[model samples]
Target: MQATKKATINIALVGNPNSGKSSLFNALTGLNQKVSNFPGVTVDKKTGAASISPTLQANIIDLPGTYSLYPKSADEFVTYDVLVNPSGDEQPDMVLIIADASNLKRNLLFCSQIMDLKIPVIIGLTMMDIARKKGVEIDEAGLERELGVPIVTINPRKNKGVSELKKMIDLVAKEKQSVAPRDFIDSAALAPEVVRDIRQYVQVKSDYAALHVAVNHGELPFLNGGQKLAITNLLQANQFNKTKVQAEEIMQRYGRIKHIMKNTVVEADPLQKQLQTEKLDNILLHRFWGYVILLSIMFVMFQSIFWLASFPMDWIEAGFGALSGWLTNILPANQLTDILVNGVIAGLGGIAVFVPQIMILFAFITVLEDTGYMARISFLTDRLMRQVGLNGKSVMPLISGVACAVPAIMATRNIENRKERLITILITPLMSCSARLPIYTVMIALVIPNKLIFGFFNLQGLVMMGLYLLGFVMALLIAALLKLFISIKEKSYFIMELPVYRAPRWANVGTTMVQKAKIFITDAGKVIMIISIILWFLASFGPKDRMEKVTAHYEQLKTAHPEQSEALDMELQSEKLSNSYAGVLGHAIEPVIRPLGYDWKIGIAVITSFAAREVFVGTMATLYSVGESPEDNDATLREKMRNATWRDGSPVYTLASGVSLMLFYAFAMQCMSTLAIVKRETKSWKLPAIQFAYMTVLAYISAFIAFELLK
Candidate 1:
């Protein structure tokens, strides 16, 4: 037997948050990456494999973007530790230091810090086009001379210079090309007496050398063992001089950087860049027009989701129906056939139908982020958000919740204030998510009248918009209420760094859409499939006597009036369904909900839907299809629903019932996955349980009032 040789290399991509770091990672790795936890930490660890050539493959780790390796938040701390120590398990052969060419001054601080690690470093100079547009010119050779790294100008979105970047990585990894060490700033040289004094009270092999290494590598007290001991001893001995020494070092580093830029860098015109950004931001970040423009953008985004995605949604629905019909035709008449058509296919179909909506939502968000408008939104909402016990940055997550709660929750990681972040997370679910939109749309179409308002504007669209506004109001109120009780001093105020405006990156937009769609299809699809199958079995076979009665009724009707027999069979089958086991389950709970205007079947849907709100539509579609056995049509479903009557001879799905149902879904904690995620993120069952209880109580109260008033 011949053994296959395996090759491995470790590499890290380090850069600022918006410097096209993630875009580059996606392009290099393509679909060959996995996001998982790093050992015991909850921070996401993104790892991927990229084969630069047939003979060479590199294991890439996308580290969290940070300005310096000095640990702060948990996310940034990970990057600091990982790069400095380069664990025996992750001893990287090469480090790709990504920097935004446009923001060279700030980006180079991190680049210079990483060079002290003594690893084979390569520079991925991204956003070169933006840099050129801003009249900033960088001498690549000068940067290489100063930083001692191979610099490659890359446009990741366009895939420019990527191949060269990879080739450089291989050569550096193989030791074919050597990078000279830069003239790193020496902190010891700047403060020789302070270093001598620090060591007198503390212990280190060489005080000056250790302090120089610590500052060069951006090591804090925790990482520098001897420096930490010296700090403690110095604090015990008089600490006033130690504070002066630390501040002096920071000032010296900036001084050296300014001197280097003056000699080696060239600026086309410094005033021009500022003037351009200021002129655009005048209208965009204005006190009044800024808010107006933001609202208009939001309005267009929501309307486009509904109008633009209508065709694709229809195509998805029809395609699934045709496929399911074909499967039913080919399969033998048995339990397996029923499961295939009604269970697996139907469940998957329900989620598949919403793909277009999800894609559109993601696309809009991507464009906002790419054009740098999202940062402005934070600035615009900061004052108001502060009133509700949140930072300006909290606006990003709240707005994101309009699309989906999962990513919105992830966005909260950017909020530096712990108290404000907790408040934001606690209230984010109140924002009307895209998942809620489907349920809202179906109910609104069924209950609300389609009337023209003010000549052309749609009343239905306005109501949809109103629901969103109501959610926002509730979010603010709830956040304020929580802040009053869960008191924690807000330590940090919001400081947003707004990047210069630019055109949207369509490649990034498409990449994000694909990633979200995959999660929807795979993760959400599995749960829906299992639920669909279970519901199918429950509705398909009933009690023996009930099944016999249904068959006998159909037979008798067919013999007596053959011409009308088929319709009679379907009606009798539907009637017998009322006495089946599933029907008994629904009926058992109907009295409790009867005051809210729902019958037994809707009762079952309401119950099952508590597992996930979107499942409500699929549940009804399956239940009604099984009951009526009629052609699938929105009109047919509506007519069947309209004619459905209870023992009291009143219609079941009236406007009042639909309105109550809509209100219930709007406030319910109907997603188990969200609850689980909340528990995981907050690190407690206490918060999740409290959230579920409060939301459920609020839902019931709201639903009851809607039913009573509407009826």
Candidate 2:
């Protein structure tokens, strides 16, 4: 008997937003997934391996969620490019199209488009419970016959029907058959002569691919210059009008869909009462109550970050401090010991201690997104967004900015209006991201009293909320001002589908929280460690002659007054730091930042943190640990910072200085990653340069005003 052959098959999972596609991917791949960027694009490409059989395995590629094949953004363009160009790297052997059973008509639009590509396709009907709740039932067998593809109803969140779905996928992969149902649209009539000409020039799988080549031949990556010119000339010669063809094709496809729905789908009533989603929205999306609820939610989220995560944060800080002291005691007195204890351990501890807060923030965000409340947030803020010259869709990116601005800026690609998209990108960094949390928490702890207001609300928590609100308010004001300068003729609209509210998936939330924390430790931790080592070197050694003279001077003082030896030792260390390379750089910039109530030490942190905002905490940890004795090594970073004083015997972290620094970070565009992403998204340095210039000016002016007023 011949041995069974083993092979790898590529399966593409495509779906609309909120269609449970990602959930299915997670169920299938579990911990086997890897996320990277698509070639030459910043759009995320998530792929994973799933074993279908003992000898057979499938590589699942989770394509970005898009409405249809018509590309509107860079992300959609990726999906369109892969589907049309069957010979590309991402070309699929079979397609698993996830359809929301609750809204099959709209979901099937894209499904039908996929079928027309002549790929081997299977439909995974998700959200069955949601469909039943809405009093809708789908005849899966009849619908399968109508669409001419295998259909399986799966609930990945509950692991129901997942094995059956896997069996179907394995069967389809082994069969290697293409299911091109001819029920959707008459592709030949859409572009007859043009399609015929394109098929002669390229290996077209179906007439739909031919039509796409004719319409998009100029930008298609598969077509060379000669083929592109030939197709372009052929299209012009045949009088192929793309817009007219697209409209006709959509209308014709929907007409057929209407007929299919009548035969294979059933609904209880067209004039049914309000949906559960609608009832909830009545309260959550109310004009007056919505704003109040939104603010309350924001307050609670910030409050929880401080209140809930404090114990874990304190534990982490205490653990690191103990470890540092232990290492200090064991290690010999040398430069290596100082580098290991003061630089590596201290820097890592500073950022790692904040992991609990970051995890909690991400968990809350995940719950909001998964429960469908995030969409209503957009709906609630649409009017206010329009007042700021943005549409409702901009709210997603703006809210996402609270986590990170790089992906938030990428999210702006979905906005069709150029002027609105640009404005959103410009203002998104103002949203206090997780990176800023470390700085804010550290500063607030040092300056703001840990007291309660009204015997309930924590004052420090309230200040944190106020900082977030200030960022949001400034974003709006800046956008409104920018709107006057940017002019465009296109009209903008926000058409979003609000998914039904469901119980928060605890597993998914946990996964997200862990993943976000891991990313911070792995990505930001590397930068912190490298900079810490370099900073230790810069702070440890000065010019050879200056160091010798300082040592000699300190020795003479110790000889004269042995009782003052310990006090004089600290003074000698401080004097050496003033002459060190890091200190010199800080002193150079101190003059400019002095008016804002920042000393030279803060000046160093401000300059170093431009690489990333979170590095400010790490910088502080390394700087503070450098001159401290071994006995004081066990103090937490907050305590160390609280005890810091300026030359005039004033607290360095005074309320005025803390507020000034917070305001500076709130408005400043210090993140290099954000700026790089902006350049990539806009495809120009002009916008990033302008962004940097304006944000720096705004940060300085805001800090100056805050310090002056508060002091």
Highest TM-score: give the candidate number.
2
State the lDDT of candidate 1 residue by residue for 107-151, as single tens digits.
877776566555667889998887777787888888777666789
Query: For model 2, what is the alpha-carbon lDDT of residue 674?
Result: 96
List runs of model 2 lying over 4 Å from the truth. Answer: 1-5, 181-183
Per-residue lDDT over 1-711 for candidate 2, one digit per residue giving the tens place of the 0 to 100 score? 988876889999999988999989999998999988877677788999998876778899999888888887678888888888868988898999999999998999999999998999999999989888888999999999888889999999898999999888878877865485563687988877887878999997988888888777877888889998888788778787899999998998889999999999998697888788889999999989999999999889988999999999999999999999998899898888899999999999999999999999999999999899999999999999999899898999999999999999998988888899999999999999999999999999988999999998999999999998999999999999999998876788888888889899898899899999999998989999998999899888878888888899999999999999999988888888887888888889999999999988888988889989999999999998997878888888999898888887788889899999999999999899999999998899999999999999999999999999999
The predictions' CA RMSDs to the true structure, in order, are 4.5, 2.0
Error of 1 at 410 (Å): 2.8
Clashes of each: 0, 0
Evaluated at residue 461, the lDDT of candidate 1 is 67
- Worst ten-residue run, lDDT, model 2? 175-184
What TM-score does structure 1 among the candidates reach? Answer: 0.86
Cα lDDT listed for each candidate = 0.73, 0.90
Q: Please estimate how well model 2 matches the true structure, expressed as its whole-model Cα lDDT.
A: 0.90
